[model samples]
Target: MHIQIQPIDYSIILIYVAFVIGIGFALKRYIKTSADFFLSGRSIPAWVAGLAFLSANLGALELVGMAASGAKYGLATCHFYWVGAIPAMVFLAVFMMPFYYGSKARSVPEYLKMRFDERTRCLNSISFAVMTVFASGISMNALAKLLHQLLGWNYDLSLWICSGVVLIYVLKGGLTSAIYTEVLQFFMIVLGFAPVVWLGLKDMGGWVTLKEVLRNVAQDPAKVGLAHDTALASNAMTSAWQPIFSGSSANLMGVDWFAIIFGLGFVLSFGYWCTNFLVIQRAMSAKDMGAARRTPLIAAVPKMLFPILVILPGMIAIGLSYIGKDNYRLPPVAISESAYPAAVETFQKFAAGRMNATATTAALQTIIKPKLSEAKIAALLAADSQQKLDSSAIRNGLQDAVADNDYDGVILSLVKKYCPSGLLGLALTALLASFMSGMAGNVTAFNTVWTYDLYQAYLAKNKNDAHYMWMGRVVTVVGILLSIACAYVASNYSNAMDIVQLVFGFVNAPLFATFLLGMFWARTTSHGAFFGLLGGTLSSALFHGLTLPAGSTAGIKGGWLATLTVFPSEMAQNFWLAACSFSACLTLTLTITLLTKRDKSDNELTGLVYSLTPKVKEHDLHWLARPAVLGTLLLLACLILNIIFW
Candidate 1:
């Protein structure tokens, strides 16, 4: 794993780092006051906001985790970006942004406060803030682990490098530096992954060879096509292949088209686009409401295309395994059991011939080391069969010889192998940029919640700009340390994304359900929000506790329910995890809303039904129709690509 120090890689990474630092420093002048620092004085442009949005979403864990999943499953995993995320995003732009901007809230919880009551705002803000810390820590720990593994650096050192660098500029200039740096990071991520994809495809002997190889390896022709049975089956349980699907059992019925359309697909999308502080911060920084909405809409096109940027590389990695590419595939599953048969044969052959016994045993051990456990073999023999068996019995009896493997590592190894020097540098920089962008967003959101919800609302009722700004910096420092501690804890967890999102689901799922009800259901009370949040979270956690212990497997309880089952699969966990959360939240919200004392405010009642209002002056608002048409066409384009490439 020792890399030959390439001066070109060093230079490219150095230049990228310098560029980011330059942007951070350059943006410092905009921070004249606390509002300017935290919100960029509401003056950012659409394009900057757009790029920053993409960068904030992309991260090193995204690169590694996605590529790893692609390598493990196939093109099916790309659904998270393409089918799951994009349509939802477009929905966000067309329908949700207007409500958020038009409302003129500083944070999402602020919206809750305005929409519901102080208690709901405080509850959601604290939950979301804690969630951000947990999520950000996982991302940080993952990136740190990857860097540590890739560059032979210590994990703590890697974590410090990532957390410290982002914290410095963020604490210095807040959202202004975050936005500017993210634009550069977006380009870096694109530059880094794009060429590697090209090279992987080239190495696989082009698309035709890739097709041939896939046909050979998969033993199925339909796997390469959209709606292919094998692909669908592999991705069946989790809409990891498409956001519109899920599975359920007797204990839980899985997400249907409705759940996806309304819950994650619709609710999560609108929630993220309009309310997620990190995303809305960019919009909030915009000089006007039009730009706030337009920035996300502009960003939507690339958000749709991100599968091309991120997922395709992993798909290309899968394609690489065909056409005689050894770099991608690790040894097959059955190899662990079968390996000793071949090894023992070789050993017997050598012993009969001329190799020394000790030498032969050493060689046999080397060959069999990864496949057979000696204890398992001994136990198999010790079980006393009908007739006593000898060494030959042990060798021939071996049944399982699976090569234990790690696909995430495989993609990185491929990157190091085939990605040329300058491109390698670009890839590393892009990954770091993504990492920084994601971390910065998480940290920014954490500070936003802490400052707005706790500091201003509770701690200091009459603070001036200077006092609040100082508190912002102080809170940022404290938040960074807490995140670092979370990262340390996360170092021991497998699949950082899964763990982070699971924790998020357990907490945020209820919140998402409650918020949806609060905004749309006027009867939803503060009592409903509170109890709904608690009930939804507790129920999901209970289900998770029941099903998660057994290792993930296939063809069992399929999908995310499978994950929450004793048998886990990637989709299984996500599906049921979401199910538990959403159901608990919704059921509780409704039940409590019906029973609780309802608020009588006219504004509150009217707001719930606002979108249903007909445009009284349709002719006067005709200008809005053009963007709607354009946005539809854009959405259609993305759909066509999904049909073609999916």
Candidate 2:
């Protein structure tokens, strides 16, 4: 499908980019030291930090990829927010924040070093830096793909434009610039997509109409050419909780509630929200400990509402397609040579019968003219007799032709179809903003890890603050360059979320166990923490490898060793893999700590470990203003949402 890009759209995008760059340059003078460059001088307010914390994770993947999943899996995708995100955000705010903020750790890895040892910190720092670069590339790649598909923009040009913009601003203002731009992007994204969802619902005749259409389509597999049975498809599309406990093969998400709760909710969620410095750095930049603690909690409010802006577009697109209002449809063409002969014969027979029986042949001719002509039908039949078609190939081609799975394009397609030119510019700009926010977040995190955790701490420990600050700027440029390379590599992957989850499984999944033990269990010796982390990471890789399908290169393909066993779905396999890895890490860490020498004194562990840390004295703050109160409210809200949606 060709999309016409209006001049207004280009102008709006250009203005947005310029404004963002201006913010970066405006904040340049603030980077007087490495801490200022990396941590925003720890002067950010709770609200600003909160939004940035949310925006950091709201990259191209969240917008495009989640929309794609919404179309594919229906309401079940809400698990990413309700179960996988909210609880973890609350945990980070209420439980983990004290240590993260009180310990004066510059990065998550730095925390590891203080809690565990230098080796563990090095392991985390290297892995996190690599992950951030790769993640930034993925966001960049997704943005380029969206622009190319939606606006007919050149892919390479899009990449260059976005990368250059992100690089300029992030280099100038560092984390402060990134956070300020993120806050701006957060507003732009909401303003941009809120109308899209409103307009979509309006076009689709509102919520009831959409659900009705989806239900009708789900009940008839032939309508959407779905492979699943009627009941499965209908329930999968309409209800969030009804099919969650069923076999993975029965639901579109390919996972049961057990996996959702344990794999995603417990392990992956905690690991990411708690330990991933890419996002935690935003909270760490807050003006005070209370602000830092409230950052994720503040962010969680909007985070919970994102599915409406991001996921609903895909759901609306799917609904429109079912109701025959969407432009996306299977082409009016046949795949099989043998089927073509029969089709032509049937048309010919119908034409001949109508001609003989009808008083006016003109009427019959008019009825069939747009679809097929007698001459064309005869030609098709003649060609069919002359050529042979492979039945299997024809079947596969037909399946591919009919499956409406370019879900990632759903939102872009909707914007072109429904949004007017001026509004289209705003929506497109919002998309660009989201991609920039995601990339900038990762790039900023990368620079900090590279400069402080890796370079300064290990390679140039004796360097002055001024030299390190300059190196921070230099490393920011290097980070963006590496991210651009990774973006090219990311284009090869089919699913942005899947590849990201795989990376989390590799790094975050195992690392969370170490953090969990070290923070809560005083017996967790540095040797034990280090070895357990190593063991956990290895076990994650081993489980992942063991589950690879016969020909797949990434993710758990299926069953153990791709043959000895089989899983219900790739998602289910991944969750189980994470659960196993977490258990292994916890077990190994405990066992190792029992055998190894412990830390010399509780004094050394003060403010870092739970048992040794002093309890924070209560402040004369309002009840509602407390982190614990806010966290409870957020958790309750999440639970209520789940129950309502369930």
Candidate 3:
């Protein structure tokens, strides 16, 4: 929908921007060395580092992509938080943080280098550098798309503005700036997005009534003109755990308990949380090993409740349509070829400017509106169930339902609908803050990996601190430029989370297996780690190439090699492919390590290997303050939440 921003909104956004830039200037004087620029000189306290750790992950993907997934997958989206993130964060804090912090490795790749071989390090560094840029680009794409969808801003213009702000702050204060700004973004995101959720739920009566509406919308998503998750139900979309056990055919997500537990819960979650440098960098910048270990654990608390902020809005947005509030249907999408030909014709007509925007949207929605008739929707709205919103007024803001539905815009659309002028600016700033946080986090990560892992390791040696610091700042600019290029590539996908999972599948899935072997199994040779990573990544591609999601074409979405099997959904395919990658990597690494001789002695492994590393003495801390105790409590809380939501 077209949104009209008032002067108050613009002023709020400007003030927020000024504040972040000022933070960079405030911290600039402290950036004295490459360590300061890249790793915050290891001085940030536990709380700041912990919030930054979570906020960095709560970027564009967390806001836009999670909301999109919520609309498409329903309560199953909570899996990303409760199942996927919490377990991994707990594991990272209790098990992995010691190696990352105690070893004093500059980055995740550097950790790999110390643990394995230069070949392994080189492969990881390059792949990681590329992955960071891609992630940053995805963040950029979400920001640009949001502005375009809501405010009619030019995509390129919004992208550069977001990148430029991120670049300025990061270039000036380095990782410290990014981390501190992320802390600020964390607050802004919560304060800003709170209104939309509160107002949306208030307008819909309460959670109880909203559930009634969600049950209706979930059973027939296309009844509200939704493009994704076209075949889900109340059981699959409304419950957190039921659909998982319902079997693939019974659930729209098309995955069983095994896929959810193994693929997502174990491999994908650990790979991203334990190993990905983007979030790990925040912990690595912590002032001490204690703070570093607590980083992810601290991040997990708010993360447990984030579904209310991010996911509920998407459900509410579609629910509004079902309850006849403002005629708030999801926008139509560019039809997949497997769908109706008439919808494609309508979309093309709108694309080619052969029809008026309003008329084209209505016609397109009608074609794709499914068999759920208008009478059923009218009767349901008039039925006077528990849904107690003002049902008399149904404004057809069909202008928003154009030929394309950027599901990433779900949260933004809600802000446009429910937020007042002052709150609108705040909400928009929150979106902007999240975008910058994601971009800056990845850019900072990219610079560190490039400067230390690749440039210093291979291209140059023994560089002075001044030279390395300069390179770090220079690489930040290069990363921004590369990220802009990658943003265009990201714009091709509808679901931001889908593309993110796909990237993680290729990069982190196999890398996790390699890291697992190297850290615990000291017998793992460099040759084994290197080839295992390569083979794992290649295996992920092969599995993806051989399998095609149902109702999907064979290309970038997979099955380019040949469609040997068809998955019920792209997400399910991602899960299985990641499982394949992890299994292949672990097997290959073990087999190769058996034949290869270890070049480094057990004594050399020291802090780098878990078996060799000394157990951390926690006698100094209070019982509640200990990382293990806190992490156990956190997991218990998470388990309670899962059961409550189930």
Number of the predicted model whose lDDT against the real structure is largest: 3
**Residues 1-646, candidate 2, lDDT per residue (tens digit)?**
4577789988998999999999999999878888899999999999999999999899987798898777767788889899999999999998899999999999998998888789999999998888888778877887787777557799899998888999899888989999999999999999988888899889899988888887776666455544444455566676777778766766776787888999999998888899999899999999999899989999999999888988888788778777777555422222233454443344355444433323222232343222223343334334334563344432333333323345667778777777898899998898888899999999888889888899988999998998988998888888888888877877765566455647556667777899999999887998898888889888877777677432345443433344444555666777878888899899999999999889746888888988888865547778888888888999999999988887
**Candidate 2 residue runs with Cα over 4 Å from true position:** 225-233, 326-404, 492-504, 548-562
Cα lDDT of model 1 overall? 0.64
Model 1 lDDT, residue 133, Cα: 86
Show model 3 residue runs off by greater than 4 Å.
Answer: 226-233, 334-405, 489-504
TM-score of structure candidate 3: 0.89
Instruction: Provide the overall lDDT of each model, using Cα atoms, as 2-decimal numbers.
Output: 0.64, 0.79, 0.82
Ranking by lDDT: 3, 2, 1
Model 1 misplaced regions, further than 4 Å: 220-275, 322-402, 492-501, 546-570, 604-627
Which residue pairs in candidate 3 have backbone atoms (N, alpha carbon, C) closer than 3 angstroms, thus clashing? none
Better of 1 and 3 by lDDT: 3
Residue-level lDDT tens digits of model 3 in 1-646: 3788899999999999999999999999999998999999999998999899988888887788888877777788898889999999999999889999999899998998888878888888888898778777877786786687569899889898878898899999999999999999999999999988999989989988888878877677666555544556576678988878888766657788888989999999999999989999999999999999989999999998999999998778767767778776565442333445555444444545544445544565676543323333333334323343231221121222233455777787788888889999999999899888888888888999999999999988997989999889888999999999888877775565465657566867787898888888878898889888889988988898899988889987889999999988777898898899999999998998899888789888999888999999999999899988999999999999889889
Q: Against the true structure, what is each candidate's TM-score?
A: 0.79, 0.87, 0.89
Report model 2's TM-score to 2 decimal places. Answer: 0.87
